[model samples]
Target chain A: MTDNTRRRFLKTLLAGGGLATLTGCDYLSEKTWFRDTLAQGETLSDVVQHAVTPRKAMAREYTPADISPSFRANGTTDPDAVEYRMLAANGFRDYRLKVGGMVENPMTLDLAAIRALPSRTQITRHDCVEGWSAIGQWTGARLSTLVEQARPHPDARYLVFHCADRYGRSHSPYYESIDMEDAHHPQTLLAYELNGEPLPIANGAPLRLRVERQLGYKMAKYVMAIEVVESFDHIAGGKGGFWEDRGYAWYAGI
Target chain B: MARARLRTVYRHPLPVRIGHWVNALCLFILLLSGLQIFNAHPHLYWGSASNFEAPWLSIDYHWSRDDGYSGRTQVYGWQADTTGVLGASPGRNGELEGRAFPSWLTIPGSRWLAMGRSWHFFFAWILVINASLFLIWALFAGHLRRLIPTLEDWRGFGQSVLDHLRLRHPTGEAATRYNILQKLAYLTVIFGLGGLIVLTGLCMSPRMDTVLEPVLEFFGGRQSARSIHFLAAGGLVLFVAIHLFEVIVSGPVNQLRSMITGFFRYRDEPATDSATTRETRHDG
Candidate 1:
């Protein structure tokens, strides 16, 4: 073939290949097998991260000066649920956080009861899955204190946080689950205050989780119940969290 | 009358050939999927948190009843209209969509951050493994040495630059080995930019931030690391453009064949005594 023809052929070939690849990716994304195959990367990341980092490694904390002036509240700002609105109307005075499931002691604690427990105040960055971050001070009772008091069963492996909000157009109840390791981490908290003030309704009023090491989605807001379970397979979408059920990685370490 | 001989040399080994193709594929998927992920936020910041008031770079769109759709890209303090590409682009349905990158540039060709992350992370693992293997092989096989420039190579750097600008590639024995410019560029892309991109990627991960706190500190913060990651990726794209341009200018068919089949063919001077002697010495 002439040099010009060869060059033309190569150009056409590259263009065809590129188009094919893009369409192929789109097609593969729709297939369950391809998505499952892709999920192996998430598994790998989780494993590698756990292997390299200390189990109790704390997320970086910032001072008051470093706190963002305006923290953008994402996901469910105001839960449309009637019960949530009623609780908000009463200033969450009668709000109760139920800790149950596979725990020996199923405890129901009110806001003051929860606040009476050992509390921690930390100023850490909240990283969203969309790639934005906000630094704010979070004050709440240590999740470990509650978990210890509840006395989880030996078989209990995950802590599922059932929230008051329903997310997106589907109106799916927002929920997230984390392993015992993260549940007991020093930074993990059932946060009730933001920037030293009561957590705003936009940010998640009454209470939210502060899983500092994970992305914001993993930190379920407006947490109404904490269920200790052996597995999250029977949960809402059966993938641990609302976003996870919608194709986000269950392990949000990355 | 003597005729010119077409001398062939085994330029690329099997491992190198495999690594090259794998790296190329990984880079393509990573870049497109990365763009898809970037579209979710469409802005970059510095330091720890995203200072919403001021961003290092941002892609934004404004739609008015009279003006229709207008896309704007702001870098530092400068702004430019980048419609049909950045800020607003043609979507899967061929309608204008407010997105950081065009649909054609994304993996799924739509706004799908979850699938995009899946693609990005999957290929990222492959890229890291492939790069690690290639680096080890290069180190032991003296391939790394060939990429590093010598004092002699540095002395000829100016000439090499001029030759490259003139599109004058080496011939005969010189074709078998990398030139000084090639060495430096390869070194930078392979070790400098490649390493930076991967490290910055890790820095973006909250979990990784805990493990690699020193690296996070070095980059100032996660947001800073993220900005640097995008810049490093841009640098890599630039390198690939120049690399492809060089390949095409020098000889695409020959270059492609060499990368694929490991054999490189170069035109030799007419079968003369002196030319034969010099070829033998260089090959040896």
Candidate 2:
């Protein structure tokens, strides 16, 4: 179908498609296990979303005119730790992002080394969970290329990002994770530049993640380390990320 | 005992009965949780991007020496103080809290945005799926016939509105089917507003932009889509409020019973008028 027709069809489907199948399905009432499976709807949503959308489907790119004049930095805009301060003082010259854990070949790459790798530049909108959006141009090395060089173990299912920012009373270092499927996605990047310049401290200088398809929180900033893991259950508070531990969904695709 | 009797008829089919209650419960969950989600930013813009400099709508709380407590709301830059009711209000514990849309109306009753999102998405999926099945079943089962407004209905639509405003209702045969106003309301809610809300919601999802490029264009951009989504949800809330009011005013017991049991006890005396016999013949 033409794009216009497809869009119209989707609109129609959204109005009249899934009602009785979800509401009047007697099988759910008849079976206890079936009823319990509703809790797994999160995982089901993830799987179904992945199944329908092509793996390489790129997020919409914006023109330079579309870029926001001032992209407001949110959450932990600045990390006050001595190590981060020292690195910032020296313009992140000594910053090293360690990629290890379940990888067959663990690697420690610094700013120059990461920049030397192949990179991609794209302008895209950042959608926050707080119902705001801002667009900025980002330049970064493809994460798939980095992971491939690191050579993850066959059992590695997730890539955990450990950052320098500490938050809340617990002073917990901020962290986030993504599955192997997303790790290898073409658009997933280890960004080091924003708006045609080296990323500012407020924008996670040195290194940050740009998981374009997910919400802003999923794009953890202030790079420090990466750990390949089979499961995220034992990391941080065991919910995958600091925010995830605090009730955010680990798979924050939206 | 040689007297008149009340007539009853099957008005709501089984799927319609199930879809109605499910949609109601899902809408309840979605609206509360959606408000909770909206409370996080509490600001809206027209275009794709928004910085503090340019917000079309905002709810804010401020303190000043002259005014110990104050709340302000700005829509399209028009400012108004809504202190005691909107921007700042008494919490459940009777202490003042600064927020738009009180905690009581929110899902978690606190500023837990993550939990609010969870509740919103969970019910959102249910609402979408339930509406979808209802639409398909409605088409095949001939349920759509009752909802789709006829040309005759269009001509009488104004009269129906006037009747409703005057609290005058039809009797016997005329009351059996939905009035023109009711038909129009159902058609708008089920097809127009319902579809718009869902599409706007999908537009807000960053990932769905690829699939919904045309929809996003139609809505202008993400922030505009968000604004439209919020407005559409409000429309649904208004529709429900008026619907419930009419139900109660018309006759709550029989109206609610029709939905719950698929049978409606006729509101007028039976076998006493030509209308009742004509309706019986139509049913046959």
Candidate 3:
């Protein structure tokens, strides 16, 4: 072939190959089997992270000076639930966090009672899955303290956070789950305060979770209940979280 | 009939050829999916946390009564209208969508961060594994030496640059070995930028951050690492562009065949054959 013909051929070949590959990717994304194959990467990441990282390794804590000037509250800022509105109107005085499910001692603790528990204050960076981070000082009851108080059954393998807020137009209640390893992590907290003040309504007021090592979506906001469960199979969409149900990875460590 | 003969010499090894193709595919998917992920929040910041008011780079859009939609891209206070491409692009319905990159340029060709992340991570693992195996093989097989510029290569660096600018590729036996510029480019892309991108990717992972705290610190912070990662990817894209251009200009079919079948053909000039040419004429 002539040089010009060869060059034209090469261009056509590259463009055709690129278009075909992209179309194929979009097609594959819709397939459940292909998605499952992709999910193997998430499973690999989870296992590798757990194996490499020490269980007790703390997420890097920053000083008060490092705190963000304004932390952007994403997802559901204000819960529209009637009970949540009433509790917020009264400064969460009537707010009670229910802790049950596969636990020996199922109990409900109000905000004051939760604050009275062994509290931990930390200035930690909250990394969102969308790729932004904000450092804020959080003070709340250590999640391990709550787990110990609840006295989870030996069979309990996960702690599911049931939040008061409903996300998106679907009005699906926001929920997240963490394995026992993350639930009992030192940095994990049922945070009620941000930057030394009461957590604002925009930032999941009353209470939110602080799973420091994971992405922000794993830290379920506006938490109302903590349920210890053997598995999250029966949970909403059976993916352990609102975002997970919508195709986000359940393991957000990466 | 008087016709010039061509000599064939093995160029790439089997493992190298496989790794090259796998790396190329992984890079293509990684770049497109990464753009999709970047579209979720088309803004980049410096330090750790995003300073919402002062982003280092941001792709955004403004809608006014007069103008239906004006897509704008800002870099360090400098702004430009990048409508229909960078800041905003036409969606599947041909309506302008407020997305950072165009659908054609992104994997899945839609606004889907979760699926994008899945594709990115999956291909990322493959890229890393393929690169690792290639590096180990290259080391044991002495292919690493060919990629590194020696004193002789350094002395010929100026001549090589001039030759490249003139599109004057080496002929005969000289074509069997990499020139100085080729060695430097390969070394930088394979080791420098490649290693940096992987390290920065690890820095972005919260769990990995705990283990690679020193690496994060070296890059300034997680956000900085992320910015560096984007820049490194751009570098790789640029390298691929030039690499392809060189392949086309030099001899597309011969270059491609050399990579695929591990054999390269150069015009056999028996009259010009010297002792030096004969010495370096062994198969790679």
**lDDT digits (tens) for residues A1-254 of candidate 1:** 99799879989998999899999999999999999999899899999999999999999888999999987999989888999999999999989999999999999999999999999999999999999999999999999999999999999999999999998879899999999999999999999999999999999998999999889999899999999999999998899999999999999988
| Preferred candidate (lDDT higher): 1 or 3 | 1
User: Per-residue lDDT tens digits of candidate 3, residues A1-254?
Assistant: 99799879878998999889999999999999999999888888888888999998889999989999988899998889998999999999999999999999999999889999999999988888999989999999999988998899999999999999888878899999999988888899999999999999999999999999999999888999999999999999999999999998999987
**All predictions: root-mean-square deviation over Cα?**
3.3, 9.8, 3.4
How would you encode candidate 1's per-residue C-alpha lDDT over B1-284 as one tens digit per residue? 25558889999999999999999999999999999999889899999899988998999887888876778999998999999988888777777878888889998888999999999999999999999999999999988988888898788788778777777777776778888988888888988999999999998899988879899999989899999999999998999999999998878889999999999998776332223354455576
TM-scores, chain A, per candidate = 0.97, 0.83, 0.98
Give the runs in model 3 whose Cα sits over 4 Å from its true position: A1-5, B1-4, B270-284
Runs in model 2 deviating more than 4 A are A1-41, B1-5, B64-69, B267-284
Candidate closest to the true structure, highest lDDT? 1
Top candidate when judged by DockQ against the true structure: 1
Q: Enumerate residue pairs that collide in model 3.
A: none
lDDT string for model 3 (B1-284, tens) is: 23547889988889989999999899999999999998888899899888888889999887777777778999997999999987878889998878888999999799999999999999999999999999999999998987888897788788778778877777777788888889889999988999999999989989988889998999999889889999999999999999999998888889999999999998765443332333355322
Ordered by DockQ, highest first, the candidates read 1, 3, 2
